[model samples]
Target chain A: MFTAPLVVAYPYKRTVGTLLSRFFQSLQEGRLEGTKGSDGRVYFPPAEFDPVTGRQLDEWVTLAETGTVVTWAWQSAPQPDQPLERPFAWALITLDGADVPLLHAVDAGDMARIRTGSRVKVRWADERSGGIRDIACFDLLEGAS
Target chain B: MARRDVAIVATAQRPNEVGSTLTSVELILPVINDVIAKVGIERQKIGFWCHGSCDYMSGQPFSFVAAVDAIGAWPPIVESHVEGDGALALYEAWVKIQTGECDVALVFSNGKTTSGPIDRILNLQADPYMVTPLWPGFDSLAALQARACLDAGVLSEADMAEVAARSYRDALNNPIAYAKENVTAEQLLARPYTTAPLRAHDCGVPVDGANAIILAAGDAARSLAERPAWIRGIDHRIDTQRLGARSMTESSSAAIAAAKAGVGDDRIDIAELHAPYTHQEILLRRAMNLGEGTHVNPSGGALVSNPAMAAGLARFAEAAESVFSGSADRVLAHCTSGPMLQQNLVCVMEGE
Candidate 1:
């Protein structure tokens, strides 16, 4: 067998745009922000326009760090570059006030602890950057089981 | 203006396999030659050529440009390409015929999924800022969808295992299929989960392959094949890109596309659905309203051999072949892209 290093890279930069700019900016401050749609639904990861109406949304809502797991799949063995190096649950979490859920990894210590509707809270990263990784991952809330 | 009738006259596909050392041109040339030979058509006489493939799949930019060599574009033939599955390219060819610009078109697609980490490569399709940065692989995302379907009571682990069991049993008849066996749901459930709630059999086996199809309009179609699979209706629709925002248990886009494609207007004798996961096959059956009478995935579908970029178009070829063989009068062929059946294309065909 022959072997060689094959690296696929996109070296260019991209603008995060209006809604995401604010969302990421908030992440740097250890806070979460969402966009309020014309239908009064708050969307986490803030969409620039309402999904149903296609209307521009600029209203921002401060979101809680805690949320409930809408759905989850246990990753028995995490792959390279994934959020967690060890076994974890990849979950869709609906923040306390948001109608839509955001996908992220949950460090629940073991598969037995994670389940649908389980409460979780963000575990902030030590170094804050204007990115989703600012909140490293969600952790199971104490005494929620 | 009344649209002209178009039909798939000829089709060819390479066997789905892993670690194919052949180049894209090497892999595509034989299929292209075979399809054109079946239709008895000259290379220069072909009105238009369209191709579907992703550069990221081969880890080479403008990878599809190399495939033009397979068709010998030196005579300056009309050509185009899509950075997706070949079914979308077939769609463009169908539209071209409707526009009265081209009477005959050739559509082809190929991919080497075994070249790299396919699961990680597919993650690039997710949202760059929010999702891709997390590097959530396709299998994990599919597992989440399966979990949601389980929670909603739309499907159970037993149901998914049954889909796998049936597909494996059916694939025994398919020469090109990679996975073929006579297994039971109980046997599959006894196995361990690769990703929670999803066994290895629940997912499609990734392979490297290519497929080509020849589409002709009106008189050209009638003269080419004894019984052509005429396109009755074709439509494509997509749901939200946000995986968390959409309903995981149902495929709204598939339902919409099926209705627009006139799937419910007639009794579908066969359905070749491109569902990569076992639960997804069940979900799509519900979305398209395909009943128990409809023969689903007779060629074993993607659950047996799923080659990225080419698998979707293979469904079209498989369904049309059923018509050509006089096994079915009306058939429904479906293709999907993105995560959790987020985007769907439904093409209804009939032998007339």
Candidate 2:
């Protein structure tokens, strides 16, 4: 029997392209933005091109941080590198003013607190970075089921 | 000119298991040898060699290159590798034969899931900028999709439970299946959720395994096996990788592939769906429109013995095996790759 440690590390430095450049830049500045597709649907975290028309999108639409959870799954056991260490719900939220949903975590105290249509808002990370983690996770809003 | 005829003549696989002491080449060598022996063909006669595997799962780069040692690439064999499931490689081989380039081709795949954290490693396949940064495990992403299907009334927990129950029961007869039991849907529903809305039963048990398939064209296929599973039609399609851009409840790509592959043109006796998740089985059945007449997952499907890179090809082998065994006249072998069935391959095989 042979035993050896295997470590594969390939550091990647990628440039966020034309459309996503503005989106990630806005995230770092505590603002959310989406691009309008040719079909007039706003896409948060802005896609480089319209999914339906395959047309390049340049029109940017500012979006609100607050959003409604379209659907979610409770992560009772947190895995490494997840948004949250403790239990949380992974949600697809249709942020206000965006037609499409954004996948993020909801810091609902328990699974009972979050549902399909739960109202939630983004909780920006303390140390800001131009990445998806800029929004640490979504915190469930009070007075909503 | 009419389309070239291609058929799967022989196939071999190891029993799915959680851990393995064998290296990639060691895992693959026997299956390749077994398949070649089953057909009694000389290795040099194998026109092209196509391998399907993930470098990430192997914990090393150029992993497939090392696997070629198992094939003993002498006289410089023409070979290609796909960083996906073996079903895709089978598609490539099918095309190779159609081009009149090869009369016979060998397609093989291996996945040592226990070598690494497969769930986390698969995240790298997601959108590097958006989805991958979140590091959402595949199971978590699948749970999100399952919840959407549940919320949309496309499927229910009970429906998912029933799929698992049936798969588990079916696996009892499958010697190579990793998970097998005589379980009931009610019993499965009683189990707690591993990821809410998804119990442990709902997800495929990952295992270390390898599989090999031999493909012969036209008359070459006729002389190879007593009954060769002829490839009638095969097609593969992919949906948008964006999690939010598409509908979670349905697999449009699968429906398109099934339609193009002529799944509904005639009666299907059995279907081997590469659905690792129970909800995905239901989604694929609906997408492919596989009705009550089809015996779904008689080999217990991937939910019982999912070996990542090899599972999809196993579906192909299982479906063809049924045809070769004269159990069914026509069968459908479906393979899904990426999250939420983002990519789908449909192969309709039949007996002469």
lDDT per residue for candidate 1 within B233-285, as digits (tens), equals: 99999999988789988999999999999999989999999999999999999
Q: How well is each residue in A1-145 modelled by candidate 2, as lDDT tens digits?
A: 6767787878978787776777778999999998899888898878888888788889988988799999899899888889999999998999999999989999997998889999999899998878899999999889965
lDDT of 2 at B222: 96
The global C-alpha lDDT for each of the candidates, from Candidate 1 onward, is 0.92, 0.92
lDDT tens digits, residue span B125-184, model 2 = 998888998888889889999999999999999999999999999999999999999999
Which residue pairs show backbone clashes in model 2?
none
**In candidate 1, what are the lDDT values of residues A69-135, reduced to their tens digit?**
9899988998888888999999999999999999999998788988899999999989987999898
DockQ of 2: 0.84
* Candidate 2 chain B worst ten-residue window by lDDT: B113-122
Worst 10 residues of 1 chain B by lDDT: B67-76
TM-score, candidate 2, is 0.99
The prediction achieving the highest DockQ against the true structure is 2
* Backbone clashes, each candidate: 0, 0
State the DockQ, from 0 to 1, for candidate 1. 0.80
